[model samples]
Target: MDKKEILDTLKAAQVYLSRLKSLDNELESAVKQIINTFEETERNIHDTFSNLKVVLVNILNKRENFLLEQAKKAKTDGLAPLEECRNVISSKVVGTNKLITQGNSIINGSAKDGLAAFSKNASLLGSLPEVPELKEVPFISFHVDPTSDNEVKDILSQLGEVSRIAPIQITELCEKPGAILVEWHSVENDDRLTDIQEFRLQRAFGDVIKEKHLLVNFNDCYRGLDTQFLVKDLKVDQPYSFRVCCKFEGIQEWSPWSLPQVASTSLRPFSWKISDDFLLSNENKIAKPTVDSPKVLYSDGPQFCVGHSVEFTFLEIDSSNAMLGLIDQILPTSSSLTSTPGNSFLVDKSGKIFVDGIEKCTRLSEFSKGLKVCFTCDLVNDHKVRVNVDCNEKRVTYDWSIDPDYKMFFVSQFYSPNWKILVE
Candidate 1:
């Protein structure tokens, strides 16, 4: 044979061998699973039968006791009349015997005594009534229903089979303020012909799972590309539990529900207004507003007035040239504080504070994550600009004389992707 033909045959043989191995593994797994299911079914049946036996025994014992009690009551009730008759007969016999003795005594006595005895006998005979005939009362009988045992047996035999799939489990759950992302996959890894075509996401909202009610049910159409779904529009600072299930496109059945994933939303600040001149990317922008807090604003130029003061807080500062301060000129949208043509105070990632292209503070502690650094421009007090690093109690104040012709506004510039701001 040719070498190419031999190589081709070898590859075909290898593919066939792999398929055979996979089939063998699948068959072994299926056999084990079936055996386990059969054993579980057998155990359940045995338990149910044992319980039934106990229940039936208790019922029969109760019935037997009840019947025995009824029989004793019947015997007592049936013998009452017979006992009264016996007592009456015994009293008559005693009276007759005494009368006979009195007669014999009178016969052997004198005439006066005989007359007295005869008078007493006549009175006693007139007072006596005729005796009634005695008969035995019939016994009461209890009859058992012939069909009851058969009915019970039928009920036991008609036990229904439970049809259910194995439970699925959630592999990962991620959460952000006002949003929750859920990811799950099937546990069985069943490779049936019915491919999963959709996922159902369910959510419950509350501090406790048992106390919570389902608030959302969403169906995500699956294209076999991703196993994750993101649920938005959730309330911040509230606890939520999520579960998901897989459904086939054409089939009506859905896989068993996945185990619930619990998470709570973080505190998200209010959305702020950005100036039209500055370009703001969609990334790192806060969407939802804090319920009780004031609105935040961002502008290309510093919003400075003679009597009014404006403050800006640095939510995040990742860039080396992230700037936040008052500017007297309308800085170019693309320029940083270093290139702006106005008085500007800025903080960098290296913990340095800068003003007008000059370093003012060196190695001051940088703001920690989630810490806010405030920049207040007080035009009322000789255009005094204050930079508070909100870390280590560091504060810097600058006095600048404003030109009457120039308009000043709050300015912020950050080139880093993680830079964020909130104006207060």
Candidate 2:
């Protein structure tokens, strides 16, 4: 019984196992097929969704690209006016640069080109509006008169004898005997606004005439005064031989001197018409002092005959302490250096001037700044006249009363009065 049962159970168990195995295999296969089917459906669905999303995105991008391309084509077609605008901007830049260049040319060069063009057309165009002709030239005038009896002779004697004095020159247009005029032709032609007409003259007494203080009493209508001149104080009174001279400004050159004319003092009141000798018309014995001695009369020197050069000889009195040459030039001081001839026309005589503190040099220049007296003879005429002179290295004259008794004791101590006159 056990065997049979065991066989049947084994068979039953085998069959059931076989069936189970087959069912398990079929179930497994079926599950696998289902899973595969499910996965395949999911994959298909996912692929469709992805394809749809891509199509949507591609449509959106195509719309944007088409809009951009259309806008680009519109811009290209509309560029003509923009091109014109760019050209206008560029033309403005070029015009600005041109204006700036023209402005700079005018400023940097002071508009010289414009001025040159104007000058070329001046005759027809006339001068620039409101502008006047340039008148920078100078006119000079000289006046000389010696009609008086002794005035003529006195002045002539004072003018040192020269080989040839410049002939007295007068304006050919207005020839006046008493008044002499000179023109600095070079300066006149170059800067003149008009022809010089008249000049003022100042007068004083004595050698101071060399100082050249006389103002050129000329009219300004002719032209402007030339500032380019050797401006110096000239003497007014006394005697002088003046010649008009001129020099071009900046051109360091002097024109030949004009003909010289004699200037002498007349006792009469100064008159424009009778500008020269101031003739007294009548006369007397009283006269302006002449060069007869080395001492100045009126006791003191120089003031009276300012432009006169003096070689006073006061012999050294061995017994007297008369202290060097004491010059009290008694001439009354009426005018100032510029107003009227001052005390005298004297200059520094270096060491030669010192008489107990006064000037004692015999060789006194015309405008002797200091009264100079040199000891050559004894002074006797306690009361004598006076002489005048012009100073410095120019025209010179002397005024002194030298005693005939030339030899004196001043010779023993300092002998002949030295000849020394130096201008500082």
Off by over 4 Å in 2: 1-4, 38-64, 74-79, 88-424
User: Can you write out model 2's per-residue Cα lDDT over 1-424, one digit (the tens) per residue?
Assistant: 6999999999999999999999999999778756765685578667876886798689879977977787677667566555676676676566556555655666688565665544343333222223222352222233345466478567545633221222213232211112222233322333422433323222223333234444242221222344221211222333544345433344343333443334543322111111121111212111121221212212211221221222333211222111222242232333211121222223232323332233444544422224334222123354332333332433223334432222111110111222212110
Ten-residue segment with the worst summed lDDT in candidate 1? Answer: 287-296
Return the top candidate by TM-score: 1
Candidate 2 is scored at a TM of: 0.19
TM-score of 1: 0.38
Measured against the true structure, the TM-scores of the candidates, in listed sequence, are 0.38, 0.19
| Cα RMSD, each candidate | 19.4, 55.3
Scored against the true structure, residue 159 in model 1 reaches a CA lDDT of 52
Point out the worst 10-residue segment of candidate 2 by lDDT. 407-416
lDDT per prediction?
0.58, 0.35
For model 1, residues 114-224, the per-residue Cα lDDT tens digits are: 666666665765455444453446458888776997887787787544534443567876653346666777777566424777667676666333443353432343324
- Clashes (backbone N, CA, C under 3 Å), per candidate, total 7, 71
